[model samples]
Target chain A: MVLPSFSNPGAGPADAVVAASPTAPLDAFLDNQPQTFYESIYRSEAACLCILRLLPPVCRQIVLHVLWSHQTLKSADLKAFCGMDERLAPDAAEEVIRPARDRHIFLSLNHKGNKFQWPLSDTFKRGLRNALTGLGTSNSFGAPYARGPRDEVPTAEALTDYGEDTWESILKYMVSSGLTNGYRGGRPRNSVLLLLYQSGLMADPYDRSGHNPKLEALTITSKGFQFLLEDRQTQLWQILMYYLAGKQARGENAADILSLFFSLGCMQLGQDYSASESFPHMENVLDDLEQYGFVYRTEMGRERGQFFPTHLSTTLCSGESGASRSQSADDKRFLILETNYKIYAYTSNDLEIAILNLFVNIRIRYPNLVVGRLDRRHVKAAMDKGIAAGQIISYLNSHAHPQMYNHPPPILHPSVTDQLHLWDKERNRLGAQESVMFEFFSRELFDETRDEAERNAGLHLALPAKKLLFVDPNVREAIKDFIKDKQVQLRGGI
Target chain B: MSYHDPYQVKASNGTLITCDSAAKQILIHLDAQRDGPQKFIIRDVDDTHVLIKSIYVDMVRTSLQEELEKNTYDQDPAL
Candidate 1:
């Protein structure tokens, strides 16, 4: 179940920097969970495998090494095992060992001799060993369903289409929700609709109480706009994270649900699993996931039905491979931007068109081509609604037509990208700072006060003619003392 | 030399507005309209800056947007 690292070998230095931490969504989610939750999560072999695959390379190596031995490890022992030099050992211990300890993967113990030692959690060790050896009776990896010749299972292509269609409909709902007419497509399930609202991706502007608002009433929030711009993998993980959070909030068994997700992540795509045998208690969870396009289930016969994990579920832990494959399949380069700020998109898909309509002013639509213009107003409107300039540019660049890529670099016309940025910047023309204003002072008093303020590095603004000064609020008392001293000296001179 | 307070220090909540000279002029014009209960601009800081009541920041931004839109040429239609 150990999936290969999906970090692109051809990625640049920036990607390498990001790869250093390798903070997958699962890693971030696990980091926030309490120790008790980790104990629960470690009980499932599939969940253990998923956590191992998601850990940073260094930490994964350390965990594997600790899995076989009963010996307690000290800091120096871990450093030596990592093969680090003396100077870098402490730093490595801080950067790598600390997070592992915090994650409860490593248990620190006070030995009888007053020496501190780290041991792997017993639950994690047992689960991981069973996952590696394939010797567990837990059936956490899923039990295969015996299908007869007459039983019709979906082809991989159909499953992919099913997943994509269901997932895209959800995205389409989000995008269309922002429109004046609102989303007209088939609405997602009520649970999903609630999750969308709870996640703050969509909000009901009219509903003050926020209690189970209708799908039509929900508008795409700023977070939703940003979510639409993310690659499919990140977007899916984000939704799943929100779904888990909602489950936890509703007093559900989140650890069990989480373990099920991890098992689903490790399951084979296109293989039928006996739903009754594997997850008899998780019927509601499976049904909800069906709405989210994670699994396709057959109707129940005399016995409980079989469910097939779609590409979405199998590739959950595989990360970028799934995203890149899906991108190549459906997210081909289709946009062309010109120097005149006109955009031509070669897409007829309603979902793609809806996403484009978020920021582009469409002029006309042919059968397979969309003509639009990047107007300041439309871009500003999108920005006001919570989309960033960088997101817009990156979206355009990632989706630019192949012809645009034929040019050396800067695929989109520089003028067009620059204007889009300038349009965003125009909204931020006025910078505001809060300060205390000192006005109506005599020229002599103003000069003296300004000098003292400047010396204290507290002056915000100075107007010689108006005899006014705005100083930092932090230095007001000191400026007042200086002014009072000046007044006393003037009075004594008189 | 009179016995009055040498200077007055007013602790009013104000936002120091910073922008280009052209935008500052538009802001000055906006302050002069006095459309709300109070004036928008507290003091003209300089050619390129102004201090205004913090509450009026959004009002100032919208008016500026409308004004800028009028002056800006539509490049898309030009082609």
Candidate 2:
């Protein structure tokens, strides 16, 4: 509270950054949060874990180093820590402090000589320290089952397999609508499925029951297609954001719900975490977790149940366990993209087939495999649906079979990558635009204006012999202004 | 007039559908689970003004899947 300078709370940056940072999916949480919201979050041990997990490397180092010293560091010190000089103030602020500062993650104080001091909240500092050391008495982290047997605990590997199956069911659920007879098995937990519809992930077809709408029917959206291809971490956060938003709309405390998620994330997989001591909302949290396979609940008689953290539970924490689950999927690369524009994907996974269909024209589906081609019409169809060409190429590159990566630098075949990009660029070449067409009797004025404006290249088209010009509509206003000024100059001369 | 959004265009034989040109949102025909047989995304102008396309969750999966099955056949290479 030295200077109380961390004031200009940033809902604007939060909202814009969250939705706008489509590349950084984790930034979605930072969206639409006011300073007070962040303050309340920082005060809780569980919520602080949520924020601390997403801090970029440099910001993390600074927070940890600052929190440990129990002293505020000046903005200049932060700048220096980022290896930036005083002259590079803007870059330093943007690269080092802006995200945390914008989110009001750091408390800023005005010290002597106009320097600004930044520190972590005491509650946040204590919370993170306790999480790292497992030292605090706060029950934010759920405890183990009472009188639980040591012999029956599930192993991490078993939890991971179950995590993959159930979690992937949700993904498969999206594409099922696209596949003939693809929808199968019970859908994801009712809430998660509803969240999909509610979040506009997968949509239901048209309904007009007049005050009673249909919720059973569902289909994937273009955004849902994009979600399928996103890195696992981004996909998880996207669901959480939508789910939490829905919960909050129902009048629940969002920060507490988030803290519960983060606390569960930080726990050990396969361990039985107790309920009564921590997580007063234990029943609700477990019910939600069961859907996502975050925890397995067991009840003995009338007493409240004990919960176990599945490997999926660690999806929110560091990528170690998450990485293990991902490696299994990534281990045997399913896709093979050839220079001849042919695609051979080895997998019975319907979700992969549906995604491949986004940019590839499938030729045949055999047992355990499918063959396809990256054709012009297919690519354009994807583009028309708002899926970008670059996304297609990268998806191919990441899933390329191991043999394909044998070349130096280990990437997709250069010719295939080149052709994919070339096709994208070629198809986008011809575009129609609205323009202001001009015709004049005076050749001199027309020639002069055309010379000056057409310098923008490809933007202005002229039929010189006919004394006509077509100016890009965007530049029409600017050209009008220029003409008015020219008329003023001519009048002055007269 | 804003052409009453999802404004329909007539085909030569007299069915109202959105033809290729000047169409923003794709007009898809669907057999709605709740509303019975109908065209998706686009509905009768008389329907509620609140029918939002974004939040509309059902898709014409059955018909679309039929069309996709045809596509799967066409894509088969000469063998």
On TM-score, the leading prediction is 1
lDDT digits (tens) for residues A40-131 of candidate 1: 98898998897787766788888887788877566667667766664553445646666577668787644556444677888888999999
Name the lDDT value of residue A58 in candidate 2: 78
TM-score of chain A of each: 0.79, 0.76
Computed on C-alpha atoms, the DockQ of candidate 1 is: 0.47
The worst-scoring run of ten residues by lDDT in candidate 2 chain A lies at A1-10
What's the TM-score of every candidate structure?
A: 0.80, 0.68
Docking class of 2: incorrect
Candidate 1 TM-score, C-alpha based:
0.80
